[model samples]
Target: MSANFKVLTEDSQFQSELSEAGGRLVVADFTSARCGPCQRIAPLFEEMANKFPTAVFLKIDVNQCTSAAASQGVSATPTFIFYRNKTKLDTLQGADPETLEARIRQHYGDGEGEEIEDSGVPGHIDLIPMINKAGCECLNESDDHPFIQALTSAGGYLESDTDEQLILYLSFNQAVKLHSMKVKGPAENGPKDMKLFINQPHTIDFDSAESANAVQEIALTAKDLEGELIPLKYVKLQNVMNLTVFVKNNQNDSETTQISYIQIIGSPVQTTKMSDFKRVTGKKGESH
Candidate 1:
């Protein structure tokens, strides 16, 4: 085992580490000393631990923790399991270095080594500041738990009034290029089916939202409701002044949809300001 990563010999240790990881990604390498491929990939796995410092890396010996291996269904040595908030995101059975690295980058992203692929856009940033709070509204929401509570306040949550459906309307102070969004909620009552509409002239009701064409529609996964950043269609959400989110239902067919937190990530579109325009008098009325 590498000195850089912690080795888990007991199931309790594994559970403890996972609990402490919270929302951070946890990569567990189940290996045995007798496995030839495990030895080959140990060095590279250690290097990844150093490279992605933000993620928690662990080495679990299958022989030492047989119960833990059985629980995770790790029949083969050198099995890599990816987890976040105690939920398994992905799993690999082989010792392929490229594939392992690709899987890590797929979820957590490469820290500063990450390359910006979107042309003309600098990078993604928190677009919550650009939201026009006064214009924001949520239909079928409880009076005590308004939509703004989910966005603006910490430890605040939004609850539906009567049904599982919720229509959230948000207008931005300026045009923005939306990258992605995060919606956090309970596992059972979280949003399941979602439709996103951009640049709508006014707030859309549930009927119009269901009938109208949406920019992007997605079904939220278990990990997504646990605070994973749900990506948007980059090409479609380029110049958005407003966004409408329609929550069609909950995961467990619950009566009310509950949303605890909402985060919008994007960059504000750059446009010429009035201050940038210089006053020209046509050379002292020469043209007149």
Candidate 2:
């Protein structure tokens, strides 16, 4: 009903709006009329549209315009497709408010805009660089599908060339409390089972990954891959200098598994004593 969100009943308007978006960010919510999650995320999406005036937001009912959804590779209800410069950047599967808000903030502002308040506890920060710098190697690694792209590029990702399994060994510069995580990629090739190991000292081979007891193991569904923040065991993750992750399988048991984005959010463990530094101050009105 309002211009903040345009509800499209057909494909022509969809194409026109996308064209008009040009180089700006466009968020398309491919939703179905009967989807409960679609209804739940509508308000949040609309609020984002109102908050970010520069971005284009559109709501398209997949049931009404099947062809439109097909064109965008949207096979499920409530698939959020982000576009910039008229090109697709990412796809979020379900109603994941945290990841959606983060993506919006990532492209919309350069940290100069007003900050959004999180719950009493501070929202976690990205820990990929720390892992990368600490050194990481994946199982069944390939040159064409490098791990760096998945870590660095927005559209690039790491994929196994031969099998469904991928184990990564990551070391951190400092200790950190692992909090929530988000995994996203193609529905079929995405991870279905995952295991986390804390404080691992060496590379974990396939045999070791199978035999070793993981600190945390999770079975992920389509919903989990849809930008939802999957929180880990906070107490267990404290003082984690190194970590290991194993992708056991895919949802469809595909031959090759792929992961476009893997985001770990948490804060670094404070090891320094704050009282060590003495406060030095000048008179309020005195000039140096």
Which candidate comes out best when scored by TM-score? 2
- lDDT per residue, candidate 2, 1-288, as tens digits? 335467789977888897676645678998876788888999888888877776778988876776676667665668888764444545778789888887666455332222221212243455553453427778775668866656543567888878889887767665777887778778888889999998876887899998889999988888887767787898888888888889999889999888877777665564222233233233111112
Clashing pairs in 1: none
Residue 206 shift from truth in candidate 2, angstroms:
0.6
Q: What residue runs in model 1 are displaced by over 4 Å at the alpha carbon?
A: 1-122, 271-288
Which stretches in model 2 have alpha-carbon errors above 4 Å?
Answer: 1-121, 271-288
lDDT of 1 by residue, 21-60 (tens): 7656679998888888898998899889887777789998
Residue 34 error, candidate 1, Å: 73
On a 0 to 100 scale, what is the lDDT of residue 152 in model 1?
A: 47
Per-candidate TM equals 0.52, 0.53
